[model samples]
Target chain A: MPTMFEKIWNRHRVLEREDGQTLLYVDRHLLHDGTAPAFEMLRARGAKLRAPDRAFATPDHYMPTDTRRVAEIANPELREMVASLTRNAAQEGFTLFGLDDARQGIVHVVGPEQGISQPGMLIVCGDSHTSTHGALGALAFGIGMTEVAHVLATQCLWQRKPRAMRITLEGRLGPGVTAKDMILHIIARIGTAGATGHVIEYAGPAVRALSMEARLTLCNMSIEAGARAGMVAPDETTFAYLQGRPYAPADWDRAVEGWRALRSDDDAVFDAEVTLDAAEIAPTVTWGTSPQEAIAVDGLVPDPAAEPDAARRAELTAMLDYMALHPGQALEGLAVDRVFIGSCTNGRLEDLRAAAAIAQGRRVADGLRAWVVPGSAPVKRAAEEEGLHRIFLDAGFEWREAGCSMCLGTNGEIGAPGERIAATSNRNFRGRQGPGVRTHLMSPAMAAAAAVTGRITDIRTL
Target chain B: MERFRPVRSIAVPFARDNIDTDQILPARFLHLPRDADHGACLFRDLRGAPDFPLDRPQWQGARIALGGRNFACGSSRENAVWAMHGHGFRAVIAPSFGDIFAQNGLKNGLLPVRLPEATVAAMIARAEAEPSAELTVDLQAQQVIDADGVAHPFEIDPFARRCLLEGIDELAFTLSHEEEIAAFERRIGRENS
Candidate 1:
């Protein structure tokens, strides 16, 4: 028997050329400013967009949401990239949620909220976090600008069939454990590249128990574990989550019936299976370079000298040198200069709530520049309504507008080079935070903790 | 302007898995418009260091890429596929692949093949032991035959397999069957049908 992923990939496999690849029709294409310029070139050449109606775009990167600092966007290069998004969106006829639109947010968040993401649909976005929409039971994957152009030009994409991998999280999560912890734990065990080249279909008891938001977080990090995409088979939990959202179809009973059938069959075969015991997952924080080079909150820093492989030594050594940390120095008590809590990874409204819940009435450490940016305008609004923003602001943290602020230092929202920051976004590759900036990846809750303590501290404690 | 293909069988081993399109060609390289040779950037960010075993004198002229599952993890960037094709890689061997990579690979006449983990592990172990070792991916047989004559049957989507066998991408195949596709479209175009 085939899994849901296989069924979808095969169902859309329209034409098989002699090369043995299938032409699959793309249902929806989502893109952002950071990955939209090349598509603009196609328009210049007079190539008609293959499926213009199926694509939607938004301006996330390089869109300075902070009104106060808008004037500080002095760099002319970044300014042009921001305008290119609005310009291309206008010229290409894509439905664009530009910066002044109330609906504008991160493309991933906007897709689901707008009901554009649905079960059994094949969705492609230029951004990596496109996996977030899989919470609606859609087959979503991140595409590149070139592929984005191809999809834009042809409305169809050529894709090869993939073997299925299932990651099963058994048992229930412990108190204070979140989907963020579950993925971090997976990366820790498997290393960063454990599930490379496979579609990770999340399964098991713990996964079934997670909320749609939590499931999105899990799939969101599927990239972290080296999986091409991570998804959960839609179930009652999925249906319940999509019931009354702004875009989920009404007459939910009918929707639920379709969703119920989205599960893999009993005898379905998978290429690989990785099991995670959810109870063992603790709050995760990355002290080293990659999202995979992470440890639990209670874990100690990794010792580079003890590393077995030369490659491991180099990676660990590079991270140590860049971050300017010594081996055997505890991850705790490592002072931070800044804390950032936003990204497609963990900038959701609930993520802010989780952070604010811990930050209520607590003040950020003196001299620490802590900030929170929601993933979408809607998330920002929701956080304000829930007083999550107020909690963050009251704690002396900067409450800023949405867009990928401080995530990549795009839009002039940056950490001064060499500043140590506890960031909540995915990827801590060398120079990923900013030129010469050191970023330690952590959960939103952990970032909040770091802000309050000015150091890497366990969220469970604070 | 066209992607290069190996005359015979070649094996290129990329050790990294889940290499998103972004990493294949960094955002810096993305500044160059598409169709400008972005091939050199393929696997550029994933170098295994000067002394790493996988970073070999042997990996210099190989074609078959033995990779981990979810080999292409992030971004929907077509450059990932463009980079792979430009890198002279005709086939990718892994336990699995990213949906977009699989799609993009097939689109550009590159084979993204998935085998059982046990089979993939054996292939990886062999390639690591002898970086120069070549693996034969017989699309007709659907088997990855390593240099030592070890053969392992790998599963592929029949459609994708057909495209690779015929050297055509998905779009070309669809255009070839335009009449049938048109009829099917007309039949299903009605909402109430």
Candidate 2:
């Protein structure tokens, strides 16, 4: 019985070496601003892109969220990174979504929004969040710069197959407990390294009921759990989402016929299995540096002394010290200095809708800064057309241009040192937002609620 | 890629779990050219701290590192490996590593040696107790010779081992099979259309 992963893996197999590494052909290669080094490597060895038609480029990592003009990027070095992608894309014959293009956005967000990511395809990017494409039933994972060069030269990569894990979510999620909460809850239960060396397939009733956008959010954080990739089998919901997008196949019906068969067999066996109760999951939030150190919004901070293992106890103490949180402190009612509601993880139209619903009548708390950066240019236009931007602007939130903003702060959109922020973006690592910045990760709705109250307010309470 | 050679040097122990790529090389310096010396940027944020291990003079110029579980756990930035290599680290001994980081390390000629958690913990203890204690990481032998003279074996993919040992360029090797790739592409084109 072949699982969905095995079927896709077999389809892309070019050849296998004696060392158990198989060379898999990449169907779609997504590139971003951070890939200048890869192009440099290709040039160093006098190599040309083997499959330019299969590649797409965009400026994301180094793009300034404040403006779209290349000249206004402030830093000459950062401006060159964005310009380099355009230059490389033109020099080679690949499609480029430049800063001025309406389709331009975060590479991960641009992929699915434009329908370049589809069912049963093998996709790759230089960013770890490339796993976000697996929501469409693709076998996608991140690669390093060297692998990026190898893929450019050969359109294939050598890979050791990872074991498959099936995480089945049973029951139904409660109100205000979104897909972001579901994933945060999952990572909290299984520590960051829990799914190391495994590709996870999310299944069961709760997964099937999620919308395409929600599924993308669920899979986006798969890297946080150390999974090679995360996937959900393509179904009617997936077909509907990809039906008429820009890059959907011309032979749509034929493509659907093939995509319909992309699923695990009835007797498919997984190397590991985990079951989560959807009803038990709450609107979750991270109180510490790691995503695993999360708890229910109404819960208290974990005390390191309760951890019997010395190593774990020390890690907890360090995390607490960095976060400036104390043992047994309540997560609710903690003051926030900033609130950010956007990223590839939760920057879709649906996410903005959820946030707008909460900010319709409420003003942001005084002395606090809040921003709503849409994920893509398309998402920004859609939100504006629906008057969601007005809701956020009226609520005292800055409506910014699309690109990765404040997620990793690479483009200089960072919090002041020691500022505590409620963020809908992934990763709460120390200095992720800036040196000495404290980030508490939560769902968009929860973050919106926190913004209006000037504290970490549970969405359900609002 | 530089050919990997066996290394024997004092091991610096930073026994923190989940030391992400951000800590190894912060995102700020990611735009620096590939040829730049990244050694100074290694642990750039944590370097000046009083108790930080790398700041200790005794472990200066250490070529081997002992780390806790899930070392280099986040981000796929190859710069992290470059930072480690630039800082004169030839090998890292850890219980586990981020999948992409391990791959990046092997491709860049920096060995990532996975040992048992307890074994790594013991090595960290020994390294901390005796700063002069040196360990040898023999890739060809597939063993990590601890300071106690105990030889602990490790596993690595044979293909990776051969490449690292011979300084093989993977792109060149893959390009040599141009005929097979073209044939496969033609077949896929027919099937899709």
Query: For residue A301, what is the lDDT in candidate 2?
Result: 96
Quality of candidate 2 docking, DockQ: 0.82
True-contact fraction in model 2 equals: 0.63
- Can you write out model 1's per-residue Cα lDDT over A1-462, one digit (the tens) per residue? 879888778656656656555667777888777765556646654666655667777777777767523335566666666667777777777787877677887787788767778888789877667777776677887765546666676666665565688889999998777888788788878866677667789899999898877787888877667666778888777776666777676666876776778788999999998887888888887876567778877777778899997655766776788788888777877899999998888888878988898789899999999989888988988888888877888899989888887776557676777899999888776556655678888778888889988888887777
User: DockQ for each candidate?
Assistant: 0.21, 0.82
Clashing pairs in 2: none
Cα-based lDDT at residue A58, candidate 1: 76
lDDT of 1 at A167: 83
Where does model 1 exceed 4 Å of error? Answer: A68-76, B3-193
Per residue, candidate 2 scores C-alpha lDDT tens digits across A1-462 of: 999999999999999889999999999999999999999999999999999999998888888798999999999999889889989998988999998899999888999999999999999999999999999999999999999999999999999999999999999999989999999999999889989999999999999999999999999999999999999999999999999999999999999999999999989999999999999999999999888888999999989889999988999999999999898899999999999999999999999999999999999999999999999999999999999999999999999999888999888889999999999998998898888899999999999999999999989988
Among these predictions, the greatest TM-score belongs to: 2
lDDT of candidates 1 onward, in order? 0.73, 0.94
Docking class of 1: incorrect
